[model samples]
Target: MWITYFFSSLLRFISVVFYGEITTDFKPCIEFFYAETIPQGISGDYQALCQHYENQYHFATLYDRNRRIPLFSAYILSPGDGPRPKNTNWMIEPRLVSDKVNTGMEYQKHPDQNVKNSQAVNEDYKHSGYTRGHLAPSGHQQTEEDKEATFTLTNIAPQMEKFNNGPWNNLEDEMAERFKVCTSKMYVITGVMPYEKDEPKINNRVTVPEYFWTAYCCPTFTAGPDQNYFPTYAAVGRNDPNSKDDIVKKNTQDGHDVKEMSLEDLEKILQNRLKMPEMSLFKNKCKE
Candidate 1:
């Protein structure tokens, strides 16, 4: 119940970017991202496709004005509701938002429950002591269907009250600014954590991010060997920066640097090296 008011600016920006309304289809579960690419590290039901929007659309914007990047999550969704592909060979996991794996904790018992209301604005949840988090914000989601698909829990992550509005929020601002100045498009992802290894512990149960990262390419810019048009993006969360580990103590200060890589290379590193099953612009090198 104890929350900080420092991240007010960042939360404001997230409210704007993650703003707008999501209408439910009355189904017990709404399909989110279509699993355009399977995550490499974790194991479970996996799918890959655009989550929201369609081809070549600018994602929602939350103005942070500091780090210049959008603090949001996104996915590509497959069109319509059909039986998801079933394949054990698939590397990534397809997930349901309400599933136990997707939601770190039980919704009813968690410090913050995911709320679905178009009428609720950013300020509504800003000072709740919980981060005004995004289940999905926008990046590669280019269609109305895709956007709606991103509303699922598969895309959400644990965030902080301060970082969500502090340096973390600034990252979003920096990315948006770069997008405008370069007149380029980028696919971005962002997340938050409950605490650092050294920080005073909060509740005995809240999970924190060991690390986080995002991947993007500017088609207008240089096309790498992979033929993806965006610039290689590299950014990691507060916890870990090494490409492999997730233990809290390993995630320390001196923010991880961003690196450019191809989609294939990204996939390989994620699968074999980093040990995480998902595709994110951020990565942490786990020490052997």
Candidate 2:
């Protein structure tokens, strides 16, 4: 029964992705992965500055001076237009700037590919010894192909377990519920933020999420894009208690004792925290 519902959704999804209603020229970035099954259309590699998971997947990480957080796209698997996964926990990392020739199982380091000298750290942010945390959990992947795509670096964010489980986990929960009812095909994007100018800019490829959001249109659930359902999203962690903003900078930079969020809060929390437009589309569907 579940498989039946899953495939039904898959058919609907494929129809939209392959030949849906959008008349725009927007084309998704595509990368191929070699695994047991065909994976999502777009996936990223990890930044070279990162200490772990470099050889696993492709990521996309671009530094934005204006916006404290790095802009990022989450990993998506093609599900072959089937029922949504009973699971949606997959860790994602943003890809760093690299040439096509150096990606995907090719280890040739591009001369320019080493984490740009400008962005590379020089001890300001200390090794902190912490592993960049992933909001999307890879454990949910059912196939090797799905797992491979989840391995991308673009999907990752430097995070502590306390933060990942606390308010951040809340935001992910909200996103999952919103997706469940979404009838239109959709794509989600999330990124991390760094401290304001002067907090010793950590060049260590570490990231803090200033906010996160996603958007999609599945007319099946509505006659048109239902901004109310799963609009764009933006969410910030509670400011550190010490910093007046209540945001937690880094509790244990030593990297020992990783924190895990509550398994139960993972879903609904994402929905509640994400702001409406951040949850909806950039432009009103009617306007578009």
Candidate 3:
């Protein structure tokens, strides 16, 4: 899983993330991206992962190794055909912390010594008052393996319980419902917006996102024009209950809120916060 990207840096070094095996090309999980084209606008300390499990490519995750959180996860919309996995058991992305990973992901119970230093281990979230929220939610997957593949820590970020269980959960559910009526393949990219600087971390490990976001692109919809959210739609939810309501108003009883808007607006907000003026969610051809 050697991932080399075109993004440049001060060091002028090519961005690369080595996984279990050497990959000669970038198409390890290209099917996850819209038009087989990765989204742009993110630069700095990031690694792209072709998330694999049980000898299968499940999705793609652009991870921030420095922040120890996924920048975003891209996947095809596949609603689960069975009930959710009971008693979730989280796992670790081996390549983030090491160059050779025979297994794509492994249980975090007894992680390697340097594992805690390179990535977030199970211990990081313990007693941290933050939930291990999924960027690629398990419910969005159809098979048992795909759902279980999402348990890897590489696809997780620290999320407040109220925000995770409230508005965030609702947004995921809504996406599932929308997928049911889609005529074309739905490409979903779910991610987070980190604070401008000095962001909070869980147990001094994983960065807690300021906002959780998700957007989807389905060019053709059987649901018709009025109900069609294709070829793009987006939403962002507040992770901090005490934060101001300028972006997402506190609409729930315990003060959780989600704001649904056009995909462009979400990109605008990310650009401002990330200072990466071109912050975007999908490729140029993802829309009409």
- In angstroms, give how far residue 161 of model 2 lies from its true place: 1.8
**Which candidate number has the best lDDT?**
3
Q: What is the lDDT for 259 in model 2?
A: 22
Candidate achieving the largest TM-score: 3
Off by over 4 Å in 3: 1-26, 225-228
Error of 3 at 241 (Å): 1.0
lDDT of 2 by residue, 110-144 (tens): 32334333232223224653334443334323344
**1-288: candidate 3 lDDT, tens digit per residue:** 123333344224322222211122238888887887677656666777889899989999888888999888999988868877887788888787765765687786788778877788888899999999999988999899999989989999999998898778988998888887788889999999888677998777688888888889887777664374667899989888766776788777776689999898888888787677475567773664
Ranking by TM-score: 3, 2, 1
**Candidate that beats the other on lDDT, 2 or 3, i.e. the better one:** 3
Please give each candidate's TM-score: 0.39, 0.45, 0.88
Worst 10 residues of 1 by lDDT: 61-70
Total backbone collisions, model 1: 67
Model 2: how large is the Cα RMSD against the reference?
15.1
